[model samples]
Target chain A: MSQQETVLFDAQGPKARRRTMIGTVIGALFLLALAVVVVLRLAGQNQFSMELWGPLLNPGNENFELVWGVIGEGIVNTIKAALVAMTLSVVIGTLIAVARLSLGRYARIPLIGFVEVFRGLPVVVLVYLSVRALPDVGIDLRGWPGGQVFWGLIIGLTAYNMVIFAEVVRAGVASLPRGQREAALATGLTNGQAMRLILLPQAFRVMLPAIISQLVVVLKDTSLVVFVANFDELLSQGESIIRNLGNPIQTFTVIALLYIAINYTLGRLAQWVQARQARGSTAKATGGDDLVPVRDGA
Target chain B: MSPVIENLDLYVDGFLTSLSIIVVAMIGSLLLGTLIAAFRVSPVPPLRAFGTFWVSTFRNTPLSVVLFFCAFGLPELGINRTFYFFGVLGLILYTSAFVCEAIRSGINSVSAGQAEAARSIGLNFSQSLRFVVLPQALRTVVPPLGSVIIAMFKNSAVVGAFGVGGDLWSTGQTLTSARGYETLPIFIGVAIGFLLITLPAGAVLQVIERKVAIAR
Candidate 1:
């Protein structure tokens, strides 16, 4: 009985079991108290009143129409910015990752510096700088699709996500058994052909989950554009709605839920990809599971 | 002093503000994260369920949403506070989820035999975890924990956008607006400031990780 599978803790004796019951009761009570306090505080502030939440529920309200319209636009813009940035980052990241792996010191050293600098710097700073600096450099993107803010936000997202994707690609390539690349070269394939034909395909297959997870990170990070670039993405749009409607609680809650829904779906997609990859390959690639999204500050 | 040199104080002040927020949030997240990790690995089902719920909820939601909720929404809920308080609280709430995952992974790395042995010797759940499992688990998790901390430091820049004054990013904004067209130098300065902190911290953590690493 004692040697039975006890992954967490051993089966408890009567006395230990009683102690656990008491502890659970106390913990439950504490949580209940905390919830009560929060509710009371919010109620005291009139946050629960119909006035605060009416606009969200009332379809005929002009404010409701405006808020929803802005949020819809914000969603489109967020997706647009994220897709453009993700595409640019993946392409640039692949190039840099390959260069870093194949090239000598002159090429690799500068690339390494670029990755490190951008990775360390906050995304918000990069976006802010791009918004201000790009125009000064005569690359005004104001005449483009979503205008200056859109391009600034995309550039910023690219700068940070590119470095991350580069790391992912490098890890993917490095994780492949050396024999895979060597066998291609031994078959009279050029170095480029060997890499393109044999190595990169396997690397991409192994790294797809991580790459998709990074796309989710990029999507969430589009919110940061609101801060520096004056972009009316989902969060900023929510902010504007709150300002006009004076229902910060309701507006922010909806925005948070929307973000969670999108990011949660993306997260689940990443997990599903990971599961499929595991089933497809007998030789498990290391380091792909560790590719959790790192922080992207708003 | 040139404008860049003359604006050293702004950068210094910003650095200090960022450092303070990072320090506070790091400690807060570590404590909260460890508690959540304990819940996650507890023998009880409800504790584990609560821990999983917490991790999924916070982990899936965007940090900006969390920050905005704390900074703006809380004030409307009669919890008015300084921007620093709300920002730090938001950061701690969000980053703690990642930290909890890191710690949980650390906890998982400890051999099952260790815990079973401790139970056989009459050590209870908390005691066994404290005396046997956690020490080994924490050592293995140092590198991942370092990355989480660095992420927290970078994420602190988000506070700057929400009228949270006295951070490096905010200072850069001030400098840029004041200097008008000279945005490049100010931003470059800001980037250097961030690297100065993150690079050294990463290097130090690597050294610590190497030192404490257990041979498999």
Candidate 2:
């Protein structure tokens, strides 16, 4: 008797394809329905006006330039915040990751606790707390006259990113072959020396993709600062425009497009980095699965 | 005012409001996010493309932008733009993108072998996914999804700026606008409420994470 060969259905088989078709059909219908309702409501209210669209579309008027300028400021603010946050998150995250992996329970426990607490907290709450706490501590971020809100947001963002980056950092370090450490010890290098010269650099390179992905996250997170800070980002700027123009749908659509542009660009960048890393690792490929998502359930 | 003592009632009220919005938004965003995630990972190319587009658009766009669109912009379109509805919608949409990515990543983590085994045993597509695949994927996704939920709870505070009623942040703003009360107490109270909820959640996720580690 001959045994029948069984192929993997989990690897995008015919059945999964059928489910995908059904799901897509249902999802498309739902989204189409929602979009139609929104459009009908706008059309009914006469919000789809030529007058509103004309000014925003032309960009010829002085007011249009001013709005564009405000938008420019928002762009600058968003980039600035994301860059600063990303740098801080990487540096602080590295320190925390090291601490968590320390041999001493004293070093390990506190850092682990810190990571969990911040990782668990909502970004908004941290921002609110920062707003209330920073001024009381007598250290004001004067450049942003918006006061507590800006600092609160920055600090909160840093705290959470620290938690996320730390784990990725730690995991990268932990995954290094134990033989490397043994080889380093055999070469007469101290624990710290081996880590600094051998382990840390490799771990950082290995973890760079994950770190960059977090940068995208930090960029997206910058928009959350709009409500708390008087300083306007893309979302805030869009809101202000809609308020002036009274055309929420168009303004929102514009905002969504801007977000899509920036985030999509970042996503592409992350993909590029991943591809490059994959190519680099191909020569030295082993059993390691670097791209696996962290598990949630036991 | 006696520092903390004089503002006890106000603090309690503010805490309650923050807690309520966080809870509601967390649940709503999770359910919405999971569905979107399922769509994104669906096998159909167009469906996958659409899901990817939706997630990317929402994830890339700031939550406040989404909220403002719903709040002020919707009103312009004669949608009434109530605080509750707008806030919930914004959170769900914004968080759903992240949730989808997390869930898809989780689903991807499961080896194709498990699904193959289910199929070899004569299980159908939905049946294999429901029984064998999703169970494994859920385990991997739950902790990260929990973090996303906590993040949603925090982001709901933005709706306060739109003058959304009932939320803790809004209630604090209402109090401040009416009385010349120092902004400190109200914000502190709100922050405390968030801490109370998030702190425990963080611990719970840690526990889940450990269990996952052990299981693997």
Best by lDDT: 1
The lowest-lDDT stretch of 10 consecutive residues in candidate 1 chain A is A1-10
Worst 10 residues of 2 chain A by lDDT: A1-10
Query: Model 2: per-residue lDDT, tens digit, B56-159?
Result: 77777767677766776767656674577887777777777778878877787677778788888999877988998878888888767776766666666666
Q: What residue runs in model 2 are displaced by over 4 Å at the alpha carbon?
A: A1-34, A100-103, A129-133, A143-153, A282-298, B1-6, B43-46, B76-78, B160-162, B171-186, B208-216
A21-132, model 1: which lDDT tens digit per residue? 8878776777778779888888888788878887877787767787789999888888888899999998899888988988987868988888888888888778877877
Clashes of 1: 0
lDDT of 1 by residue, B69-134 (tens): 887767755788898899899999989988998887777777788888888899977798789887
- Indicate which candidate wins on DockQ: 1
Please give the range of 10 consecutive residues that has the lowest summed lDDT in model 1 chain B.
Answer: B40-49
Q: Give the docking tier of candidate 1.
A: medium
The ten-residue window of minimal lDDT in model 2 chain B covers B1-10
Residue A243 local lDDT, model 2:
76
Report how far off residue A152 is in candidate 2 (Å). 5.8
